[model samples]
Target: METSKRLEQALKKLYTAFHNNELNPECCKQCAVGNILDNTDSWKHLSEYHGALKLNYVGKVHQSFGRKFNGYSPLELLQIEAVFLKACGYELPLHHKNKKPKNPTNKDILFSGLSETVRFLCDLDGIPNVMAYTKLFEFEENEKPKYEFSVTD
Candidate 1:
């Protein structure tokens, strides 16, 4: 199998374990990173220039994790992070060599909408909750922003 496929499988496996309540947050996060490294196309670049993969992966991981977990548990957080990394061409099991960079700011949580297309990410270290998009558009009498659809977990 291709390295990418293997990485993807590992990441999904981690997520599945988490959804099944079979793993701890720290373990899940740590294990999933292996996939990230194995899949990074930047590995060649990082190899040619020391630290390139580490810098590139850190930024990529930060961005993906920022997008996936809007408001959820640590498990959910890792799942989303894994999803983003996979999308960006990292296979899964993000590499330890990729090395996590310190986030410039603490905020990295997901928010659904500030506009129809835009979401404001909450700080990573803070609480997670869906930032309602309804507040942006004023409704006519017949048109509510679909709050009933959103109320459940």
Candidate 2:
């Protein structure tokens, strides 16, 4: 299989395992991130290994938009995506943004762009709101809890 295929497979497998409660990096010390974080050489190796494939995909998208694409590591791109999605109201996992649970509500599920698997998990867990459960602080001091959907529960 091609390198792009491998990276894509790795990404999917990693995310799926993360979602499924397998590949618990928290439990096991031999995590991909941990390995990458342990050594600059390893981090560089992972980046170059994944970078070629990431570039191919980005190149395709850039071509479509007539935009000039430059070198950015896959991890960099992922962080950028995370920031963009957070701005659009999708919460990353707890570790990404130092998340701490806050006021509980029902309408927290209304946000778009989150993966269906994550949304489904939230629903299954009775959390009903990823934003409500993962966020630590909001700028608005008088933010009110919206629980209209709680009645339907």
Candidate 3:
């Protein structure tokens, strides 16, 4: 399926980070948005809190100036991070006291976050969910899957 250039690039980085065990919802430099932005924490300045969607002074200025980091506006970046963190079982605002997964770095945990983030990204670009597996559920003649998918786990 065709994906926007920016979405493709973002997916590539997210895939690499997930496989390399670099994704961490608690770390701004290694979280979903961080990986999309090449591991830079400068995006944190876009908001007052780690998981907030509200843009601060600098962020508003950049938005007014039409600035984009890796093809995402400042607000868009914050929203992406928020979605990822929430899907990863994080309590928004990202406090230590907030409930979170037992193993935040686990592959399963990260996958959930990445999947939701990708969905949100696709929605922003008006495209299908690139990570969807529904195609494997399609039936041919109401008897078998149109596409074959195997699972061993």
Instruction: Name the top lDDT candidate.
Output: 3
| lDDT, candidate 2, 76-104, per-residue tens | 43332333234334344324354422421
Error of 1 at 151 (Å): 18
- By TM-score, the best candidate is 3
- State each model's CA lDDT, in order: 0.31, 0.31, 0.84
Q: How far is candidate 2 from the true structure (C-alpha RMSD, Å)?
A: 14.9
Write down the worst ten-residue block by lDDT for model 3: 136-145
Q: Could you tell which candidate, 2 or 3, scores higher by TM-score?
A: 3
Candidate 2, superposed: residue stretches over 4 Å from native: 1-3, 23-99, 102-153
- Flag clash pairs in model 2: none
Candidate 3 Cα errors over 4 Å, as ranges:
132-153
TM-score each candidate: 0.21, 0.23, 0.84
Model 3 residue 17 CA deviation in Å: 0.1
How would you encode candidate 3's per-residue C-alpha lDDT over 25-138 as one tens digit per residue? 999999999999999999999999999989999999999999999999999999999999999998988888988999999766877888888889999999888665434333
lDDT of 3: 0.84
Model 2 lDDT, full chain set? 0.31
